[model samples]
Target: MQWLKVIFAGFIEIIWVTGINTANSWWSWLFVLFVIALSFYLMISACKHLPVGTVYAVFVGIGAVGTVIVDIVFFGESFNIIKISLIILLVIGIMGLKLATEEGDE
Candidate 1:
C-alpha cells in the first residue's frame, strides 16, 4: 500500500515538474505549488512505512523517468539511443533497490 502511494506521489511530482516548466500565469504557478506540496506529503507518508532510502530512490527514479518521457511526448524533446539506454539503466536500478529493500530495514 505504501509502495503504491509512493508511486502515486511520483506521478504527482511529474505534474508539478511539467506545470512549473510551462506555467506562464500566476494561477498555473499556484497549481504547481499545490502539487509540489502534495507530492512531498505523499512521499513522506510512504517513507514512514518503508525504508527512507528505498522509498526515496524509487520516488526519485519514477519522477526522473516520467519527466523524461513527458518531455519527449509533450515538450517536443527528441529521443536517442543514449537516452533510451540511460532510462533502461535507471529502471533496472530502481527495480534492484526495490528487491533489496527488506521490511523494517529503515
Candidate 2:
C-alpha cells in the first residue's frame, strides 16, 4: 500500500544517513550515492499517493529522529536534555502534519 511505500522510503533515508558515518573511501561513497538515489525514488513514489506536504514532513521527521538515535547508539554521541527535547519536537511536528492532512481529507 501507499503507507508501506512511505515507510520503506523512510527506511531508505535512515540507511543512507547511517551509512554516511562509514563512507570514508571512494567505494563507500559510491554506495552511499546509490542509497541516496534509491531514497529519493521511493520518496517520490510515496508522494504520489500521500499529500506532498505530509510525505515530505514525515520523511524529514523520520530522518532527523533516526539520525539522532543512530548517533547516540553507534557514534557515542551525547544524549543531553536538549537532544531529547528536539527529538520530541520532531515527533510532535510529524503528528501535527499528519493530523492536518487528515483534517483536509475530511
Among these predictions, the greatest TM-score belongs to 1
Worst 10 residues of 2 by lDDT: 97-106
lDDT string, candidate 1, 13-32, tens digits: 88998998999999999999
Residues 15-74 of candidate 2 have per-residue lDDT tens digits of: 899888778999999999999998898889878777988888888788888888988998
Error at 71, model 2, angstroms: 0.3
Q: After superposition, how far is residue 26 of candidate 2 from its true place, in Å?
A: 2.9
Report how far residue 80 has shifted in candidate 2, in Å.
1.0
lDDT of each: 0.92, 0.83
Candidate 2's displacement at residue 12, Å, is 1.6
Q: How much does candidate 1 score in TM-score?
A: 0.95
Clashing pairs in 2: none
Per lDDT, the best of the predicted structures is: 1
